[model samples]
Target: MIKTGLYFGSFNPIHVGHMAIANYMVEYTDIDQLWFVVSPQNPLKKKKTLLDDYHRLELVNRAIGDDLRFRASKVEFGLPKPSYTIDTLAYLSEKYPTHQFFILMGSDNLESIHKWKNADVLLANYDIIVYPRPGFNPESAEKYPRVQIANAPLMEISSTFIRDAIKEGKDIRHFLPYRSWDYLQQMNFYKK
Candidate 1:
């Protein structure tokens, strides 16, 4: 069975940091494929600053363009609202029985993982690869055997910072992929 790493996120504006994490996962871990599962709606996050789901998905596809190991997924878009990771995982497992799924998350998410719906079941069922996040201490994750800390760099760059910078008319080309940056500029996204 192919080992697929499911990296779920809003990807409001898929950036270089994201690319770095995906690269790290594919190179350092046994994960065969890294699927960027673009969540249309995260139950924990506010939707005010989120871009359209299709647009976010397109940006992810453009950001990861031509990468054979990486894919942009819209699996959560068709699912019920306030998308919960547990439900999505179940659906993906059923649809792709040949693939063994692993959850790719950051230290920040690990900190509050207990609050996620059916968190215990998730922790018990699948492996979780935790990448570093700024200001987040990953010591708490050590309690779970399924959770492993990845060697990916701790990139302080975030989608919120990117959005705020764009709205302020600040240049964010350095933080984003060339194609995604160009798309943002052409579409006038994140500008208030």
Candidate 2:
């Protein structure tokens, strides 16, 4: 069975930091492939600044262009408005029986994961590959049976910073994949 790692995020523009973590997970870890699971905005709350779901997915697709080991998943798009990890995992497992799926997340996120929906069930069932983030130490997460701390490089860049940079007319093209940057520019995203 293929070991698939699911990296869920808003991927506002799919920046270099996101790619770095994914590449490290696939190349350095036991994961055979990595999927960028683009998260749709919650319908309960109106987020005027967030781009359309399909557009974000398209950005992920472009960012992963020509990479055989990387894929973009829109599974959450058809699910509930505020899709939960447990539900998404259940759907993916039922749909793809041959692939062994695991969750990929940052050390920062791991700290607050206990508050997530069905956190116990998720932590108990799936393997979590945690990438270190600046200021957040995930060494304590090793206590969990399924949590594995990855020696992946610490990434500091954030999508929020990228968006703010774009709005400021900054040259942040190098922060994203070339194809993705082109698409983001063509679509005029993150710019007022």
Q: Over 4 Å off in model 2, which ranges?
A: 42-46
lDDT of 2 by residue, 1-192 (tens): 999999998898789999988999999999999999998964333567788889999999998989999999999999987878889999999999999998998887788788788899999999999988877666588679899899877778998899999999999999999998999889888889
Query: What are the per-residue Cα lDDT tens digits for candidate 1 across 1-192?
Result: 999999999999999999999999999998999999999888888899899999999999999889999999999989999899999999999999999999999888998899999999999999999997776666777799999999777888889999999999998798999999999999999999
Model 2, position 151, has a per-residue lDDT of 89
User: If scored against the real structure, what TM-score would every candidate get?
Assistant: 0.97, 0.95
lDDT of each: 0.93, 0.89
Report how far off residue 149 is in candidate 2 (Å): 0.7
Q: Name the best candidate (by lDDT).
A: 1
Per-residue lDDT for 147 in model 2? 93
Candidate achieving the largest TM-score = 1
